[model samples]
Target: MGCSACLWLLLSLGCVWGMGRRARETVLGTLGKATMLRIPPELQNLTLHCGEAMWKRDTEDPQRKLVLLKYSGGNYTNFMQGRNRFHKLDFSLEILNTSRQDRQLYEYVVSKASEEEVWQIQLEVYEPVSHPSIQILSRVLANGSCAVTLNCTTERGDNVSYNWASQDLSTSGLCSHNGSLLHLSYSLQDASIACACTASNPISSRVVTFNSSECNYEHGGGAGLRTEQLVLLVVVPIVTVVVIIGVFVVARLAMPRASPEQEHSSLAEDGTLHTIYSQVQRVESPKKDPTTVYAKVMMPMV
Candidate 1:
């Protein structure tokens, strides 16, 4: 029973090794470029005898055979051509004009008499990373240093990621980052503060640099409004109120005025007059009113 157990352990180890040997390898490709799917020498040697080899592609669609070769009488012949764009080489397969749709798993199958072996290759295609650009999102004063928020961007890429690099970050303050946004609080007195952003993908990478000296600390660093804006906010309303008062005083000075005595005199001059009348008889009744009568009249103020 002990001897059988030893044999079983050896068999199990062999099976594990065999499985490891068949593990798929990953290959990266750039969009609109050509990539080679190279077969290892061990699998390439399998074609020396009366062996037949075939390549198959597996994707979201059904599995499809890419190419087939038959070796007989110490010679190889192409049995099938799956696609025109695929070029068969001595020890590898070349795919031209790779696209994102071409990313998938591929199997290289070799058959020799009664034995069959398979190798897998995973292909991933990506667009090359574009040049990155940096922009200052905002700036403010924190304590005595300038706190700035920066943003990095790229025009186009596939599976793109951003990483920032800087020097003497601890001297300024704790630096924090989130994806493409970087926040830093640094002092202007601190020697030149510079930061670099690297945008990368599986196939290509790009980098950009920014300097903190470009920040307009006097203008943007203030937590509140600027002096000019504050002056406008406060002084403008006061000036407007003063202007309105001056206009009212000038209007009052320009108008005509009349005193009570002048107004009363004007009214009396324009009003109707009052007079006293007396009648005397002729000489026949002269004796009765021979004596003259006098009367005094008073006028009322208007």
Candidate 2:
């Protein structure tokens, strides 16, 4: 009987558990059927770092104050429909509704308010500032002549004005107006010149300076010729020396040394008949025709 009783108790608990789970699912499904209005995605992810509440004095009463609320983050729109008010006396957030949904929304709204009295809070907002960067496209060379173009660009700020000035007194072509760019085709007689650019507006001002070293210029006529001349001076002499050495090596290899026997034979063939005829005339003491003896000896050799 005890075991049967235990079995009945277990069955009853199982049924109760199943019914509770089914009821939970039904409630979730009903809530899911309701349309959910999402706050702006930017607002939902915003974090309010600080806020301020200024009380503007009414013109009629002077004693009654009108609330002027200013906040840093975009999440401030979330509290537009909520019935929450900032208490001046205590500087606290107070909710006017007691419903669960109202309470949840109010809690989220109040969390954005400042805990301190004076709301000088810093917030992460999409407020982009214009930061202008300047680059000098052309630069002065060592020869003291230059033509430069100025580039003015901003990451966020538009409608910028550019004013260019050289710190060197001798340089010319200063710009007086502001625009996206200022091109100055000027010449300077000084070395290491610097040009500054100023971008200004009614709210803020920014200045950037470009040094002569950072700018690049095209090689001009005289400069290009000088470079070529220098290269030739360095390279031509080296090539000429190489050619002379190569010629000397080839001549040494082709030159022939004369043997003593060949030199003697050449001398004999040139002067032997003349010497023999002169000797024969002197020995014979008569200048007879030497052609007879020459022809006899030459015929035997032939």
What does each candidate score in C-alpha RMSD? Answer: 13.9, 23.3
| Per-model tally of clashing residue pairs | 0, 4
TM-scores, all candidates, are 0.57, 0.28
Score residue 279 of candidate 1 by CA lDDT: 56
What is candidate 2's lDDT per residue for 1-302, written digit by digit as tens?
69978765654443333221211000100111221112222222222222322311122444553333334333222242354454333333333432223211111121222232222211111212365676444444455556665676656533345666766666544544456566664445445655666766533567766565323532222235456767799888999999999999999999997799989876766653432332234456466654333332332211
Per-residue lDDT tens digits for candidate 1, residues 2-117, read 99787666544433343324658999999988888878766665544324666667756474555444444455555434431333344466776788877888777766445556
Off by over 4 Å in 2: 1-130, 136-144, 168-175, 213-302
Ten-residue stretch with the least lDDT total in model 1: 217-226
State the C-alpha lDDT per candidate.
0.68, 0.43
Clash pairs (backbone) in predicted model 1: none
Residue 248, model 1: Cα distance from true site in angstroms: 35
The candidate that wins on TM-score is 1
For candidate 2, what is the TM-score? 0.28
